[model samples]
Target: MRTFYLLSLLLFALASCQQPAQYISNEGYIYGTIYHVTYESPQGKDLQPEIEAVMMELNQSMSTFDSTSTISKVNKNEPTELDELFITIFKQAQKISELTDGAFDITVAPMVNVWGFGFKNKEQVTPQLIDSLKQLVGYQKVHLENGQLMKDHPNTMLDASAIAKGFACDMVADYLYSQGCKNLMAEIGGEVVAKGKNAKGNYWSIGISKPDDNEFFTQQKLKAIVELQDRALATSGNYRNFYVEDGIKYAHTIDPKTGYPVQHSLLSTTVLADNCMTADAYATAFMVSGLEKSIAIAEADPEIDVYFIYSDPNGNYQTYVSPGFKKLLKKEYE
Candidate 1:
């Protein structure tokens, strides 16, 4: 699975555009990345504090970087009961894993840590080490039973990095909606959920990065801009967090089945769905499944709209946008 950060550069509302509404924006750091939230409500309404409280609760429940987080305790094999938040994400992960035939798995934590992509630093990632870690890397090896996690193998661990941010987006959006805000855009990390419309009375506009490997985030140029309304969007790419070793490039997206970094021309995958969590998980799954399989899966599922950026035979960037997704695109790079 690929965990990307700082990839979305969204245009909240065009300044010159008409506005019958006022949009309040709030931003801070969470989940190792920045989050920006904007919503339209009455003049005296400010939900920054409420948003922060929601984020704090989610971080405590799911962040692997926090040693005292609920997920960290579960990963350490400590006796811990699964909270509602944890169970919801766990079940959703299991569903996606099964739907993707294990391509998107939560039990790939050991491989992620070994590859220097998870909470821990990289270790000696030899072939033998990868094989040893593979033994503990199956979603089927873990399950939640009566609000407690059960493991077929004692070493089976979990990592929700792939899907947690999207869930966070959903949670924050729900909070805003509960407060009677009909128009809102909730984003955590790079995953986003746009509800109602922007201040301009138009669907929110979000830009997807051009999959440039020069920098993790700095060299951002838009590949496309999408109009989102009552929908969630997420992009997964391996352009960042990769290295060149022995004349070969190693990307961060690990194929859970192969126990190695994926080597493919598919540069990035962006998915749109009813909720951020589903979009987030499908985006990662599409990256693992490669181009053709991803398109096939997207075509079969009406709920999923996909857009892919890939490198062609001559090493030029190319694109394949699904029909449903093409309708959502506002502009493409010239």
Candidate 2:
């Protein structure tokens, strides 16, 4: 899930009123998180079954929790022809890894697990242990050779959790578009794709959350509100999934290159891109690269607009809004 929040039917129009008739909405849980879909259809089509089916297919191909899932089978080193979803995700992951100089790696799952960010309990990780684990980690260590997934080490695994929700959002949103639905928004776990207008015929409103250590998201507060249309928004942060040990802080986002959690003041990154998958990957890349490199990456990519929240030297919250994202901000904070 994202530290960002999808603003609930609150368009910034002068007149704020309810219009359930124009927008058909569905809310439920899938892929271990919440999903919300809204679209404008005069015929009032109930596509919950279709949307749920999409989620089911994605889970079968990518969910690590499913023992029989395609990814799980691959992790087990079984001879399997990767499904279309699996191939697509794997290819996309490789592209992002190269783009970010391996900042966003799917092969870092084993390291993450050892850090207690995955299914395993946290242990006292030493430099020796890290060096040993680094052997089983690296995007270059895995590849699609002649249409088969090949790994450098038998234990080298892949975990697409970082980009799954964003891809799910894109799949759901693209499915709706193919069905001729207009003026719609699809959001899975805060990675979102909003198109056209909403029920009140205004841009979709999304809220970026304050980067506080509210791990369970018990309380929600808006750091900024964005007006979005025809674009995807994804946010990545480590503030929520972190701990302090003996005055040393450890975050869940393990650096793939170093086999350790990143130590940086960069709190969160919200990226807008032509698609949710790209936005999701770069958001994590920005977090891993920290402030200066993140700014550099955003500046180089014309298709990307980013909103970065970081702490100043004084530990006060400050914002860095890329030129493209600045225009989308309906509200801002100091």
lDDT values, one for every candidate: 0.87, 0.87
- Misplaced by over 4 Å in model 1 are 1-21, 118-123, 215-218
Clashes of 2: 0
- Candidate 2: list runs displaced more than 4 Å: 1-21, 118-120, 214-218
Give one clash count per candidate, in the order shown: 0, 0
Relative to the true structure, candidate 1 reaches a TM of 0.90
- Over 188-259, each residue of candidate 2 has an lDDT whose tens digit, in order, gives 888999999997878999999888775355786779999897999999987787778798666768899999
Shift in Å, residue 54, candidate 2 = 0.6
